[model samples]
Target: MPQWSEYTDGERIKILRGMETRQSDLAEMTGLSLQTIQQAEQGKRLTLRTLIRIADALGVDTSVVLGQQAPRRSMQRDDRAMVRDLSRTVHDTAAGLLDITDPPALEELREASKACWDTYWRGSYMEAGALARPLLEQAAARLHDQPADEQAEAWGLLADAYRLAAYVANLIGSRDLAYAAIGHAQHAAEQAADDVRRALVMSGRSWVYLRDTRLADALTLAERAATDIEPKFSTATMEQLVAYGSHVNFAAVVASRMEDKERAADYLSQSHATGARMGQEYRAHGTVFGPVSATTQAVGINVALGETGKALSLIGDIKPVHERVLSGAARNRYAMDKALAQADAKLWDASLETLEGALLAAPQWARHQVLPSVIVSRVATGSTTRLRRVVELIGTASSTGGFPPATPRNAL
Candidate 1:
């Protein structure tokens, strides 16, 4: 079989639509004309907006339709395995079927949960999934064995473990497992009776919705979560500020995706204010928020809204020290946004260089992101050699038949 990247954009759309979804059905679903759908499938006059609408209607990322990434059913073998193990762990633990004879102590489970989150933020998603299975089993076992007084902490740990599982599943394109894991996380959070944890679980669920192209649902839930944890700043603890800040920033993200510039700006202002009050980066409940995060995230928001000049300006405002403070995954994400802005502005060489550097810095994480491929596809005129190199880095080289070998997690 030919690699996905070998197909024309139109062919990809037709294949993704499958026999069950007629062109008229897709047209209605996307609120586009049937002629538009037919033209898009024939690789004629398919605008970016139309492509995004089609992809959303099809329940896949634009990268999948662009042939830069495979659809969920065609995910790589290792990705499938990781999702499989995570699915089993999520379901088995929720059903009380795990036979964990010797669960780790509560403190040990807490530390393990932190380690799993650390691995995930480091962009070692496969490793994170591997770590999450045992963490979930151990946390569930501890929850079952702990007495009433200690049960809350165990439940909290289990919620954290499930959050990690959800994150991994979402990134790996296992949407069903992502929803299941986050549902279990929310249940555990509720059992713990921790308002902040519940709010964070809502934030996680909103993220799943965002990736699933349920924009309105994502925006609603993010706004609600932010409101639930809104801090007074005068007396609020660091945890409250971080949680609230993360939610507002995520709201900005969802709002931007929806092209609601006014609402996006409003949420961004709140995020910036929350970050300013916090004074520095704070990580809690598996989320990060701070001045650096707020600013870096804004670059992408602006880029999404077609404000390339604003995005470039924001990128310029980022200090070297601030950039250094971001995690591997966060840093790569920022790089992709910067490269995208540069591409939009026709700074082809700079865009390619930025993309190349990011891909080398964290190939594992870069592969999971759609932005790298999006950036490459937008650069229509560049040094063929350099463009080819960027293509190879993103694993879309037709010569390779598919993506390159997976980068070892330890390399990052």
Candidate 2:
């Protein structure tokens, strides 16, 4: 057996295809052209979707083709169980969680929502989502029982619970689950009649679009949602300010991904203005948006736009206030973006340091993110020791016992 990284993609595909399966058969099964199959086996360029299709046709995980660790059998079973549990929670009725005549107090609902948000921000996604399911059931059931004046708040709480589920699923790379969760949020927001909460749900929808590579739709929705939530800074509450700023920042991210640097900059500028109005870091409606967050997100937007110099310049401007303000996940993501800028500039050592530091700060979050893996792959050829360390931290480094998957140097 050879180290997974040592073999070319074509060789791995050939081995995976084996003697029993022919290229024509694989092409037919995967709905890919015979030529495409041949090209892939010859180590030609293939899109991620195409690779995934091929991997699935072979009855294997994408990791099998990418030369990464195949998930353990136990992990696979757990994932299946989670999916089942989520489905049941989403479809099942809340029959006995609360009395129809005497619902839980509004304050209790608010506290439960707040606690769930805290759990998510603290990076306890699994726990938070588990908590959210029951909260949602109770909230949904209680929405009809609330007085006319309090019904909106009840709906808002339900929306938040659904958003929690969607956010957690998105973070974990479960797009289908995320879509289901977002749908529930959208319906709940409609009932709530809350512009800010509706905008928040739109933000989640944009993430699902991004995951599917629908950049145009993602940008359009995010921009429209941001516009819809734009408040008069002079009178807007802190919560409104946070949601507005966060939505605008998210629009900037979508713009950058769509390669519209000017649009991205415009959105980012608007976010900065909103943050200026807020004055300090504020987490509201499950979003972190303030001066620090705008600056931090700006770094990533600049990197995505290929403005390495500007990205680096922004990094230098990050103040001590930022360290105390941003969430651990946000800080780590910013560090990863800085590392990307360094790598693009060929400052390999600085890139490695930034990358390593981020992994150390939030190992679990970093491991689940695709960015760290992408960055490490870029720098891996130069420093074997650093590569190994990153691989260890991520827990998916190539093993000698498994076959290598096709990994183009510029895949990310």
Candidate 3:
């Protein structure tokens, strides 16, 4: 049996499309000609634009179609279980199904919510999900028990918990649960009437849309959120700056995914300007944005736009002092983009080395990401031993082994 990485681009597309979706169906979905769809499945003249459209129509990330990622159904059993448990917690709490007589005080819930966000940024998503289960239940119970005077704070805490839950679900490929959690988070934010929190919730939803391949919706929501909270740079509060910067940065992300280089560049410029005004990285309302973040994220945005040289150039701009402020997940994401850029530049050995270092530094987080495998599969020439080590760390060799077969679906 060949590995998924061994499949050609066309074969991978066919597999992802499955028997349920005929070529004509795909053609209609992608707005491409039948000839184009047939050529795509035959490994003939498949352009990037066509590939993006097909991947979008298939409802999976481009990496999955490129064989860099197994479909979500190939997710590890433990990860599936974690998402299931998280989903149950999110739904049960929303329905007021939990039985809790002694809810913690607002301060305690605040601390726990902060801890969950911290865990998530540290790239310990599973641990964060575990923490969120109890936190959501408790936050919901606390919201119910709080007096009228204190209810706003309680609602804010609950919104934060739901945002955390949404993050975990989005990263782990539970799209429906991610949507549900964010929807609940938005409602809670509205209840609290915190403009900053409400804007941040919109940002979170944009992320979920991005991951789910609703690029237009994601870009629109992010742009709207940023516009709504656009603060006066001369006197904006730090919280306001962070919220605005995060949304614009995310809009840049979604635009890049849409391959709208012009819009992406504009958003990236706004993000960098905002970050410079802030002068430092600040994490708040479950989002991070600042000088370090703007610079680090540009590396990925450039790569997505096929500007590998530009991406590689930005890597040098990230000074060691600034890099030190990035979260573990943020750091690894930068490394992945850097490696991809290196591979695109034909520096195969350097790409493999960069990927190996990230895998060694954050093996668990690496396992959950598709980019490591994408980098490994793209490197045409490198130390075989080093490449295998990176592959092993990302668990691509066993991507489907020991897991029950997933039912074939027409779309993700």
Candidate 4:
């Protein structure tokens, strides 16, 4: 696992600042000397109760910081993976120690968490989410500390891990785990300050709601994230900051699913405008977004706006070869978008061809392709018998809220 030394300077600085602010505020609230506060902020000395006191003053949930190693396209061989893993473990341990109350347990958690982080970073998002969750829980239960600050931080880290776990589990069709993971994120959000970190917990919740097809709740949470609660954050600032674009795009997708085309278009326009002002390149950064969210937002809004043509054109412009590596997921997603775009244009043959190719490439996630497939089938076959088969295929594969219930209004 990675050690504390493995962390970037920026990460160290962020942790330091959080600790310092927490300390000084505690001192002022308790009428302690500024020198004492300054000394603690500088890591000169701190007592168990002092840490606990500051934790209370700062409203820190626990010592665990919600951090992730940088995303990589691919991990190295076993030897290299082992080295990176060590670094991650060490780094998480140091970060955990900043707020841990029990010295020995904190050390153990640090070591364990570092390994967890490394393992998580070592695989694809699908694999990482699955592997990291149980370990996160194991570490959480094993670590015991006294200081309130340490207690809060440790709990917070556990919550962060669960949130990640839940998101990935939900994506992969694990409902029970997703629910539990959401519980963890919610738990973390409660003790978090009005920071990007806190907002992310909310963001995680939004994803859960989306996966469940609970559009109203998801929209509510997403809109909350888009708000300016974090005063220093700009609308365009990506860093850990929440962007209105994500909310807009998410809302757009929900609207599109509901077949509320006008509403979807409105949301799409708003998202597009937000994305524009946010800058495509900047939005792609971990600051505003990463691959999934960034591309998802762009693709979703455009598709909803009935401008899939334009959206596919933009996707093509991106050249899809990220760092000379053609990510299978990205490629599949691109094809899916193209198929949908063709479907929108009423080019059934082209849509069918593209979708068939996508299904062959990655069959599991082709659930989203079901609707277009149904439409294409309907267009190609006038017989209601074949159309029903096609719809059944779609219903079985779709993650949508049970075939949209087949309302009379939509039937028309």
Runs of candidate 4 with Cα error greater than 4 angstroms are 1-126, 142-147, 151-153, 228-237, 241-245, 258-296, 305-318, 321-331, 363-412
Model 2 agreement with the true structure over 1-412: per-residue lDDT tens digits: 4665456777767766655578999899889999999999888877887898887676556775676743221122233345446546765632333434655687888888888888877766656767877777777777877777878888888888888888877765556778888898898899899999999999889987887678888988898899898888889999999999999999999999888989999999999999888899988877777988898889999989999899999889997667667776677778889889888878887888888877777755553466776787677344668767776765542221123322322211
Cα-lDDT of candidate 3: 0.83
Candidate 3 lDDT over 1-412, as tens digits, reads: 5666778899878877765578999899999999999999999878999999998777666886787866664444345446667888999999989799999998888788888888999999878988898999999999998887889999999999999999988877677889999999999999999998998999899988888778789889999999999999999988899999988988998898889999999999999999999999998877777888999999999999999878988997877777789998899888898999999998998999988888788877865676776787789988889877777776642253232223232121
The local lDDT score (0 to 100) that residue 224 gets in candidate 3 is 90
Stretches of model 1 off by over 4 angstroms after superposition: 1-76, 396-412
- Models, CA RMSD each: 11.9, 10.0, 12.1, 20.6
Steric clash pairs (candidate 2): 65-405, 67-405
What TM-score does each of the candidates earn?
0.80, 0.75, 0.79, 0.52
- For candidate 4, the 10 contiguous residues with the lowest summed lDDT are 403-412
Question: What's model 1's lDDT at 412?
Answer: 7
Which sequence of candidate numbers ranks them by TM-score, best first?
1, 3, 2, 4
> Model 1, 1-412: lDDT tens per residue?
6676888999888877765668999899999999999999899878999999987777666887887767653244345456667788899999999798888898788788888888888888888998999999999999999997879989999999998899888876677899999999999999999999999999999999988888899999999999998989899898999899989999999999989999999999999998899899988878877889999999999999999999999988998799988877788889989999999999999999999998888866766666777788889888888898988776642212123332222110
